[model samples]
Target: MRLRKGLRVCLFCLAAVTVLIMAVACSPSSEGDTTTAAPPTVKQPILEQDPPSGETGELETESGTESGNTEEETANGNDELETPAGNRNGSAGQLYALTFEDMMKMDEALNHEMNYIAVDLSEMTQLTEDDKTYIIEYLQGFGAEIRDRTLDQLVEEENPDQSSPSLKGVLLRVDKVEINEDSAQIEGSKYRSGTGAIGVKITLKLQKGAWKLSDSEMTWIS
Candidate 1:
């Protein structure tokens, strides 16, 4: 009976040892120094990269001006609406015809030049030097210093009084010139005097291969 009791004790001890080993193996480890995990590091871009090929990087308005920009540059940028070069003498004549008409009202020519009409065509690029010469010739002998005057540089060295032989001249500067096959719209200003200046917008029509003034409006008078 003692031998059987001792055998039962040995079997029970062996089973208890096996159960304790399994529990220890399955449980989370706690042997090393405990440490808290850190989150992943994410880096961000400092500057955006350039756009791909054929894509526009920066945007600009139609009226945006660039370095060394000029009137010709601005006008030629609109390729679809660009006008043919050197095809506008009608509008040119229309701008100066009114002055000629007023001169015609006089019965006779003046003994000496009293008033001057100097046209500045630097802004009107559609006309060439030859075109300018033609206009000057057309307005010649009108009791004014028209033929002797220079259209490109309207300024005279001296601005003399009426009593002097030098005529009181006005610098005619055309700011904008728009022309089509059927019509033309022109904006210009007359530098008569500091206080006697005038700005004009003229609409002209092409009739019989000539530009005739359809209407003229004084935009500003000072």
Candidate 2:
């Protein structure tokens, strides 16, 4: 009976040790499984770089604004090109205003040229060749002075009938001037011999720094 009791005690001790070892092994596996199954812990915050809000909108707005400005500049440049080079200040009327001396010079030049044109004396059929030559030479020399004289003085000096030809030329009296960049319109009265004042419009062009008559028209004859 003592031997059996000792053997039973040894068996109990071995069973307890085996149970403890199994418990220890199962605890480790369970703990490992529990640890693995749980949600992961984040120590440092995860930061991902994202573009600033409205960045694309701001970029698009800036691009549109720049494009609009470029278009406006181009339009303005085209407008500038359309305007004439000399009219940038837009003071053409003032700049091209004629003076008294200029008018006198024009009158003198015109009378000189008209002297030749007036040589056709339609009513004076009895004039000899020598007489015609002498009269033309005399008129060419003193045409302006004689024309500048009063009509009464001219009538008394010539002492001819109404059929006799008068060498007096037309005198332009400028009333208005409209100047462009390189052209001008002169509105004037043209006083012709025997004919009363007539309205005339003369166009002038600038060439080589000088104003030259481009065209002329009689608007009205009174």
Candidate 3:
């Protein structure tokens, strides 16, 4: 009986050890089953740069002046007189025609010469405002001048007024006119007190349909 009991106890002990060993072998190994944590994700930063200095990056207007600037600059930059459409051709022929019209508007011939004398005096001497004003105000119109005596009766008169000449000669006459689109060239003859018949070459431009004097640098030769 004692031997049998000891055998049973030994058998039970062996079975428990075998079961423990099987459980440990059959279970998954911690080494192969373990999952590693993903590495922390990194974010990139963005950087911005400044623009260059003293560069406005704005365009200038057609008037040759900058917008949003001073009024003085704008006024100075603007051309006071604009060339007319027909006169913009810059042709000598066109200028001559326009100049003739301007000349025709002056006072008569003799009065025109006197007006020139007055203008010369104004330039040569520093006359008072009253004298200058009088000369400018009393000058003849564009086409005709005024004289004190009549040319027909002057020679027959007993004592002709020697101070004032009766005949009023044409001060200036428009001989020819040439126009080239924007420009005009005029050839005319001018009679002055000291200078006899003097030929004049005038250049004009078409500004707003009216002929005006062109810039000296932009003279039309042809």
**Candidate models: Cα lDDT each:** 0.58, 0.52, 0.45
TM-score of 3: 0.27
Q: Lowest summed-lDDT stretch of 10 residues in model 2? A: 92-101
Clashes of each: 0, 0, 38
Q: By lDDT, highest first, what's the ranking? A: 1, 2, 3
**Candidate 2 residue lDDT tens string, 1-222:** 999999999999999999988888878565757756768787998899867879978998999999999999999998887622232121322222232113333434344444322222333344444443443333434444323333344445554576543534544345676878798886655444554445666777777665566776667765
The parts of candidate 2 lying over 4 Å away from their true place are: 25-82, 85-187, 190-197, 200-221
Please identify which of the two predictions, 1 or 2, would achieve the higher TM-score against the true structure: 1
TM-score order, best first, reads: 1, 2, 3
The candidate with the higher TM-score, 2 or 3, is 2
Q: What ranges in model 3 sit over 4 Å off?
A: 1-167, 192-195, 215-222
TM-score for each of the candidates: 0.44, 0.29, 0.27
- Between which residue pairs do clashes occur in model 1? none
- Candidate 2, residue 7: Cα displacement in angstroms equals 2.5
